[model samples]
Target: MNDTDNEITTDESESTDSEAIAALTVRVVGPAGEPIEGAIVRGEGDGVEFGGETDADGTYVEEEADTSTYTIEVDHGEYEAATVEYTHDDDGEVTVELASPVAVAELSVRVVDSAGEPIAGASVDAEGRPHDAGIPLEFSGETDSEGVYRDTVYENAYAITVDHEEYHPETVEYGHDGDGGPTVSLEPIEGGVPGASRITVAVVDESGSPIEGAEVIGRGTPHEADIPLQFRGETNSNGRHPDVVYHNDYRIQADHPDYTGEIVRHTHDGPADVAVELESGPERIPVAITAIHPDTGGAIEGAAVRLVRTSGPDSVTADAETGSDGAALLEVEAGEYNVLVADDIDLTLVETEYTVAVGDDPVQTSFEAVTEPDDCVLTVEVVDGETGSPIEGARVQADVRAENIDDMGLAAGEADGNGIAEIQGWCGEWEPAIGSEGYWPADPGRLDVAGNDALTVELEPRE
Candidate 1:
């Protein structure tokens, strides 16, 4: 008999005194105790080798063997190889259980939205196989409240699909070769103006009657690479305006001749519908004003008119613009107001105080121009800071610095071939700035038309 653990004596010459043992049985099974067929079982000891394939019941019996210990090795095409040490006292059988390689590893998946917020109750499905001939593997479950799904899979590559009611469905291929798991971000169904972009407006009177020909204007904050939220149009005969393809938070204004003006605040997540109501009464008075040139005695076109409430509990300001007939209309509350006409070509600033008592007729007045065409003009010359050469096609803008005006944007002018930009229709102190295509913007400073009519600005090129 061999003394080593793996060696079993097979010599018949020395085995006359000792009786031979019964057959040694080896059973191969999976980790879950299921039978594993076609597994190769081998044993070697004492210069004698014995091996055989497991039957349908995963059983392999050695009919002849001595009373010695043998090292058995079991191998399967779908599982990790396992080895066992067995001592044949000629009694019980040895069961070898093989484990899959994937059982030792773990996998995870997470689902979220475009805003990086987790989405719960999402369905996650995955399918894969351990090998070509191995058993198929699958995982189907819903994500937890934290939007995480965890499981163990037998394959290196898997196809995963995720679905949600409020979001678009997504599919991705995940591999277990890397460190971290996969994370999927799904787009929302009602995404924004770019996705479902439309805005609807409706105008009505106090008694819920439709008000036709009402002007509607909407403005919103600015953002890069997005559609600017600015639109203006008149309501149709049905008191409804055409859809505006924009989405954002906006301040909307609705105005009509026989009704009071209305302002509404709204937000558009996807598509939005808004309604505005105007009040009509004797408290709202209509005022008409015309502009005429003093020298030519003709009408002046395109002059901005402003009415500042000078005698009221709350300070209010209203504005309008003259049309081709040099006439504009304003609907306001009955009170004393400071009528201010802005400067334009051949016109100077006109400021006057007027009172509108209760139950008065529609007031009509005329504002005469006070300056020549070249009286209040500013000429700006743009040049390169380093080269001292004139720069053509530069843009110059001046904003009024008066305390009564809410919006300071007066007008803009472009430089001519001689690098000179002339801006007219500005009075008193103002702020001026210049910009060009290939150069950095010039520093903003003060420009008073009453003191200087010409100035020079320098621009530096970008590095």
Candidate 2:
């Protein structure tokens, strides 16, 4: 009985060992479904140690392999290594597709400051995987002297993160293609330096009224490192703007639609305050004046013109003399102005002064000159013809015609309490027409004002 038991136990041990061994077959193929030859195949785990190479048929058969779980590894000289976790049952079969090695592409990144200047010694970490299924890619390095970080990676989309000691950390998404690399900008942390300063700007109109919604820009002078410092902000409801700056010089400019733009410069030794006063109106413009001859209607040269501001702020008088082309230009602020024109020759202008409202656009007007005409005066009296009483509040007009002079006709004057109307600047024939309120009109026919100085007319009372 003892001998029989011993033989049975030995037989059972042999059977267990035979069951633990398995016949495993591995097939390798190219990406295009073509058979791969001479590809190394290895299997380990579960007491299965197997190593072999694929034949011309991309087939590797291991007749003796443990029937359990295994980690399969495949490698090829012209392809990337592939790893897979597989389970080997009885005579299990597994296939692996080897992909051709991918060529690495170049990726570059640049970091800049607010002034569009490069920043060096920045840490950069870029990592990504193929959009579909492929090998992963990663790169890590610091920027060079030119603020450039360069590396070679697979052509794929990557997320890049940049960090600096004095600035804020930033992350950006980038895609690696054949084109140029991407650029990343970092903002400096405010008050990061020991001597950081601040500034306040206030914008106001000519009337000392606060101007809101104004655009304020502060540009700092370049430093020794040539990095620019700039900031932009808008005025609040109180017409105040604040910014952080270094101990340097800065140019502040303010602009608004309802006021003229203003620029101011300031040196920032410490906490500083600046005031920008803007004019409330259109900008100054050039006014063009042309002098013309009244008799011949031709341009007259050598005429002096003056523009005096009458409605706006007091400004220096602007004077200009007409050139040979009878044109004179004067720079005048936007306001109401009284324009005076004169010349060496006889300036017999009916009116020597003109009132003009100047705005932003160029203004053009003509001034005419004529030969002086002789001055004459005439007096007329109006009365009630029915009642033989003097008529008050009567209007008298005279039309004059003279040779070698322009015909002038205008209203003379209204009758005074004594019923007398006097007209001046009459030179030749006079035609008088008189009328009173609530009375019939009267005509004294025609009279020569050069010879006569007084006349009488009667207005019949309305029934």
Instruction: Encode model 2's per-residue lDDT on 422-456: one tens digit a residue.
Output: 88754778888898778888888877778449888
Question: Over the stretch 177-210, how does candidate 1's per-residue lDDT look in tens digits?
Answer: 5445799998876643243367878999998888
Give lDDT: candidate 2, residue 116.
83
Q: Return the top candidate by TM-score.
A: 1
Task: Write down the lDDT that model 2 would get.
Answer: 0.78
After superposition, candidate 1 runs with Cα above 4 Å error: 1-181, 185-283, 294-297, 343-359, 369-463
- The positional error of residue 359 in candidate 2, measured at the CA in angstroms, is 8.7
Against the unseen true structure, what C-alpha lDDT does each candidate score?
0.75, 0.78
Backbone clash total, candidate 2: 1
In model 2, which regions exceed 4 Å deviation? Answer: 1-194, 226-228, 283-463
Please give me the total number of clashing residue pairs in predicted model 1: 0
Candidate 2, poorest ten consecutive residues by summed lDDT: 344-353
Report how far off residue 67 is in candidate 2 (Å): 23
